[model samples]
Target chain A: MDILRIATSGSVDDGKSTLIGRLLYETGQVPTDRMQQIEESSKRRGLSFTDLSLLTDGLISEREQGITIDVAHIYFHTPARKYIIADTPGHEEYTRNMVTGASQSEVAITLIDARYGMLEQTRRHLHIAHLLKMSNLIVAINKMDLVGYERSAFEAIKSEVESYVNQLGASFTLHFIPMSALHGEGVTAFKDGLSWYQGAPLLDILESIKPRNIINAEGQTNFQVQQVLRPRGGDDPDFRGYAGSLRTGSIRVGDEIQVLSTGKSSTVVGVHKWGTELNASGPDQALTVLLADDIDLRRGDALIAKENDLATSRRMTASICWMDEQPMTSRKKYIYQQGSFSTKIMVDQIQGTVNLKNGELKSNHQVLLNEIAKATFKSASAIPAIEYQEGNSTGAFALIDEQSLNTVAVGFAERFA
Target chain B: MKISDFPRSLENEAIYIFRETLAQFERPVLLFSGGKDSITLVHLMLRAFHPLVPPIPLLHIDTGHNFPEALRFRDELVEKYQLTLHVRKVEDTIREKGLQEETGKYASRNALQAVTLLDAIEEFKFDACIGGARRDEEKARAKERIFSVRNDFGEWDSRRQRPEVFDILNGRIHPGENVRVFPISNWTELDVWNYIREEGIALPSLYFAHEREVFYRDGLIWPVSDFIRLSQDESPERKVVRFRTVGDMTCTAAVDSQAATIDLVMEEIAAAEISERGARIDDKRSEAAMELRKQNGYF
Candidate 1:
């Protein structure tokens, strides 16, 4: 079975954890010991019912504060697919954590409390998800029982989210499900309460949804060399292979590829995975390619299809999400890393910070923690990059503080010059 | 789809991580525990650099209170792969460093493995320690980054962890500081078992059911061994049991099962209600037991 990675985001008390716990419990993924632990903890806390939120609040501080502070990955599997839920924090201060969770996920599940309509934090969550280019947007209007399971309340919130998503110009598949995770209504199997609603339950929607093939859009092959394997005494002596993961598109044997750094061309003689040779390999598979002519290829070098060309420039405009506590300023050099390549870069200008309230970029010179901004960067060396919309894997980069060595910001390439 | 047609995405991710670690770190070592997860790591590493054995070595911090079968398997694996193996004994660390060993029933050297591991890291100057930790195993591990960085003292600061975005990992660190890389952080226990079954990877015999003298305690079955100090109220009983996770004999618990093969073990895991770590005695100490241990440099 294939794996589906889902990121859950929303405002605090939106029951993101509870919804996840309900999903796990309904699917029989919650082990007996964990269920008992939750049971005992609920009783100790003087609650008559089991608190499913206790399952995802793994940290002691989170349990004490009754809030999620970081991203916690929860895993479960059905016969159809293995699901990985990145339960992200909802607080505005932890927006970076939400981005961290949604960055690797293909689907984004935005939870909305039925009692309260779309809050500012909810909009922020949706904005970040859209910025990350999530293929599927699952809007789960939870706590329907709190609102008396009224179809009007669900419709109100559904229309609000739809209008806002339209303003954001989202390109993903939007799905709205009304459910009460606490009471287990409309989660796995729809109960009798929602007679007005006629739709598949949340679990069914997840299982049936296919993760969009973002890589095969243009059939543009972008492979970065991570390592070079050479065995002198092996059966085939004088063997040299360039090993890396195919970030985008597919590669086949006898395909002509261009080395990004040197601009040299070579024919792919062999495509090997593990110890066996494959006739062809698709995106995301880690394989080694044997070039017909042994040209100079090292780590951080890219192998692109001869027909495709990546933007190579020392200046780049990107969308930056600041993650560190220290505010970012201009002319501060940071280590900009994309794939295996690393180079020193400085933020030349902070164009504007994104207005989460309206999904618009606002003029701002300084970026504080958890703030998203559009900025231009000047790298010490020319770098190969692509638009983030075109290639998520190859277009994204991280900026690490030179002194602290902490990842301070994550950027997506928009244009290169 | 048949089991053979299962998606190899997880394997691809793991191999990608292995290659990244090899390229980034100068002196990297795989923390081999003779468990299924670490065994799977070795297999992935071998596959990652095909036609060439992974240059990284294996480090096994031997807690003396280990299952004999696991040790035997470890030796056989090292020999089979012709890989370099480093064994640092907690027993030796305790003797040399004058570290106090816990006493009484449930007293285990599991916590003491941290000191030996730090000492080994310092000795070899290993910049990166590749582990088999998965997020689904426990709560604290769920929040851990794929490239978890440790201080010069090997302390894990969960609160100030660097943000890991997308597939790009930042492995940059300072001198005397090391990073603990977990390649299979996304994989669940069942995923590991499925991969093992698909790949037909060999594991220690302890994973399979065998007749052993065990005693029931605190709703768990403890093996009757010299390392464990059993109380007088508890008596040893012979039963067919298999271990879900292999750790120190004093900490790892056994479950009653007749799964003697990989397929049977997978079926048993799928049907079993208790989690893989549920049988572990150390984690039962408290809710933040793993977190506390991890902060002190425990793997």
Candidate 2:
């Protein structure tokens, strides 16, 4: 079964948790005992309806506050597919937390209230998802039951979002569905509240989609070694292997490859995986690769294609979504890590910040909490900054505070000649 | 190529994490125990750097109450792969009487392993210790990040944690701090077993079905030879059983099943409604058991 990683984001009262609970419960993915536990807990609280957020928000404080303070992983497998939901917070302050959840997700399900068409936070989440290059933008306009199950209410919100997303100019494929996460309407069942509507249920739509291939970089190939193992006592005493999982593209035996850092040349002796030797290598497999010679390659080094696809430049400019509570300025030195390679990068300049409500760039001198800004960095050493949209491992990097050693922001490297 | 050549997403994700620790941390170590999860971690790590001898060291906190099979497997794998193995025994502390052995039915030195683990970390000065802890196993674990940082005293401050965005892991630790990386945090028990079976991964034999000396207690099977005293209510019974999880034998309970093969094992997990940790009697000790343990340096 294909995997669909979906992030749930909405306004505080939009019932984001209920939508996830409805998805899990309606699909019968939850076990009988867990459902009983939910039922019993709701009874203890003297509530008319069972609280679904308890299924995702596992913290004691989160359960007591009746709000999700952190992102939690909730899984449910259907016969046709498997689903992993990143139940992110809907509160305004936890926008950073929502990005943490949405960053790993391929699809973003933005929960909106029918009573309130589009809130500021909704736009912020869509902007984050789009900026992060999440292709599937699903506006799950929830709580249709409260609005007399009106078709016009859903249509108005959908059109408004469509116009805004167009202006955002972040490549996105979108879907708009009216849903009642609390009542399990339009989410998992066929609803005729709007006779003009003809679309698959939320579950149906989820199952129809294929798993987003991890090999997003079609032509680009970037390989980073984890470790080199020389089996000293093995039959081939000179057997040298640069072992790591291939995240993108492919490497085959007899292909000419260049080892990074040292700038040495070697041929792929073998591409081994699945506890056996393979003639070829594919993306994201735990494979041991044998090189023709005894190369001085270790972890943190890379094996690049001969076609010239990499660089060891000590400087880069990228867009960063600052997460720390304190204002982060370009003058500060932070530890920037991309893939296995990392360096001490001093923020040289903050060029611009995008307006959250309107997707326009605001002139900025610094980045504050939850602010996305373009910044140029001068590094203490050479750092890897691959395109975020091209290669996930090589493209995405984190900026860490040297004093606290806390990862304050994640950035995508934007390069120009 | 085999039809199973396509790797499971979670397993590949974990291998990628192992590579990160290798690529990033200066002094990294595999926090190995005799559990299936950690064993799977070792296997994945091996696959991560196969053909080449694994460079990272292996750190094991021996509670001294482990099943003999785990000890045997641990030794063989270490030797076979020529690993830089380091074992810190609780018995060494036991000789010093650092912890007095319990005498009653609830007698278990499982909690005392934390001291030895802390001692080992201080001795090795390991910057990153990788383990096989999954979120779905427990509620406290559910809130855990892929890279969990520990203070000089080996305390987990769950209240304050770094927000891990995308695949970007924050492995930067202060002079006295070490990060505990959980590569398989998102994987389920079924996922692990499926990957093991797919790769034909080597595991300790105790996980497979076998006739063993066991006892019935609180509607569960407790390995009689496990390192704990039994209550009078519990009686011995020689039954065919298998282990879902392996920890301190005293606290690790076995289940009655005939899943002698990996295929049957997958079938068992598919059919079994309860979680793998549900069989771990130690975790069931209290409602806040895992959280309390984590706070006190249980990785």
Candidate 3:
């Protein structure tokens, strides 16, 4: 099944969790007994209806505080598509979490309250989504019922968001949907009772969507070999293949691929899917590939298209979201772990923090926790960095703490102009 | 469509966690109980580092009253793949007076395994322990994180969990502290069966149909064993049955099944009307049995 990954962002009490829960419930992905528990809890709490937010807010503290503390992954499948919702906390301190969820997501649904359209938290979420290079965005103007479903209120919010979104450096296809998660107005497969609006339901919009075609500009495949399989006498002999998932582009039988760091060239002799043999392999196909020519490639090495060098550069300028409690310091030594490869790197510069609202770049020396900033920094040595704008695996990375060995921040290497 | 072609977000997340554990921790072990969920976890661990040796080892905490097939399957997998297999026996723990064997018809040593597990962790100094716990199995598990922290005494502090965001798992454990990692915490029981069938992974024969000395107790098929002592009112008998959950034999119940092959077992699982953990008598011991077990580091 084609996966539709959506990252949801909004402040607490904006009904982000409720919207996600309603989407899953309307799609019939929730188990029956689990639903019964929620029903009973609602009754105990003396509520007239079940609280859908309880589904995604899974942590013990979150339930106790009635807020999401971290990014909890919630999965629900419909007949048309399987959805993975990386539900992030809406608090200002959790901006790192909002960025973390947005890093892997293809589409971002930024929720704004119709009663309080485009608050500080709303701008922060939208800014984080844009900075993460999320291609598709939906500006969900939520809680129309609270404001008597006023059309003017919805329109005012829509234009205000569009005017801000149009100026974003990271361009995203945008849409606006006005709905009330409390009353189940337009968030699911339900027909719009308010005929003031004309459009597909949220489910239809989410299901019919195909992730934007990822065309690696230079027509290349960055097949970094993770492991080399050499069976001495098991089954077949002379069977040597560099095994790693295709991280960037596609490779077919006749395509000429290059083994980076070695300058060796070979035709794609075969593509081995995890257990099954295949004719071609593309991005995210965690498979083994056999090249006609035997070349030395280990973990952290890239197999680029013979002529395509788009993702092979070593220097990177990136927008980073600091997640650790420790503030970002310049030239601090840390490990740069991208995919299966880990190498030592030092942060050379702390460029500037993002203003978020007006896309204004504020010059700064460093960033603190939950802060987003764009920096131009050189690797301690040299490492491969494609623009995080293209490849999912290569373009992104996390800075490993030198002392604690914990990953502190998720970063997107800025695309070379 | 090839299962490999399509990826479940939960499965990808689990694989990522498994790899991260291998890369980050010094000594990690996967707690295998010979159940379908753990079996699926084994397969995922294998694929996570395919072409290379599996990074970590597999540990089985034998309750001694396990089905013969489960024991045999554990050995076969070790011998077949040349995997690092470590077996810790509860029988030894009982003989050494580390745990007391329960008495009476309703008596079970399911809770006592925690003591033996803590002993093993202390012996090995394992930093991270991975298991096949799923959220849908129980309420507390649904409340767990991918990387759950444990104290020096191997106790889960429910009040204090480091926030997990994106793929960044906080495997931070202070000295003498260990982390309990559940890679498949998001998968449902059906996902495990589907993955096993899809991958054609080997499983214990006890999961399939077989003749076993069993008796009915409290609407469950209780395996007849010296440890699984039966009531005077009931008689030991042989019946065609299979274990749905390969927990401790005293608490683990058998379900009536004729399906033997992986495909048939999956079909049966899909059509079955009961939860996989429903057959576990230990869980039925209390509303929060699993939660308390987790707090005590029962992984």
Cα displacement (angstroms), candidate 2, residue B151, comes to: 1.7
The top-ranked prediction according to TM-score is: 1
Q: State TM-scores per candidate.
A: 0.96, 0.90, 0.84
The CAPRI classification for model 3 reads as acceptable
Model 1 lDDT, residue B227, Cα: 84
Model 1: lDDT equals 0.88
Error of model 1, residue A180, in angstroms: 1.6
How far residue B139's Cα lies from its native spot in candidate 2, in Å, is 3.0
* Model 2 alpha-carbon drift over 4 Å, by segment: A191-197, A214-217, A227-240, A258-282, A285-302, A309-315, A380-386, A390-393, B1-6, B91-105, B226-233, B285-287
| lDDT tens readout by residue for model 1, A322-364 | 9989999887899999888899998999899989778888888
* Residue-level lDDT tens digits of model 2 in A1-417: 456788889888788888887887787656655676678778888989987755676666676778776777777777655677888888877777788888888888898999999998888888888778886878898888889888889899999999899988868678888888787787877555644568767887777666566435354455777666666676667666676767666788887888656679888878877447665434555667778877787666777776655666667788888888987886899887765666788988888898877888888887889888888888886654466672254677788898888989988878722
Model 2 reaches what TM-score against the true structure?
Answer: 0.90
Off by over 4 Å in 3: A189-196, A211-219, A228-241, A252-256, A262-277, A289-296, A311-314, A415-417, B1-28, B45-56, B91-115, B125-130, B134-188, B205-244, B250-292
Winner on DockQ between 2 and 3 is 2
The lDDT of model 2 is: 0.78
Q: Clashing pairs in model 3?
A: A317-A414
Per-model tally of clashing residue pairs: 0, 4, 1
lDDT of 3 by residue, B1-299 (tens): 22222345455567667766776688999998888788888888877666556667998888887777788888888787778988898788888875567876677767677877888888898999899987666656655668787888888865445545444555656778888888987676656776676667778788888888889888788888777656688887888888877877778888888887766776776566566677888877654567678787776
lDDT of each: 0.88, 0.78, 0.73
Error of 2 at A219 (Å): 1.3
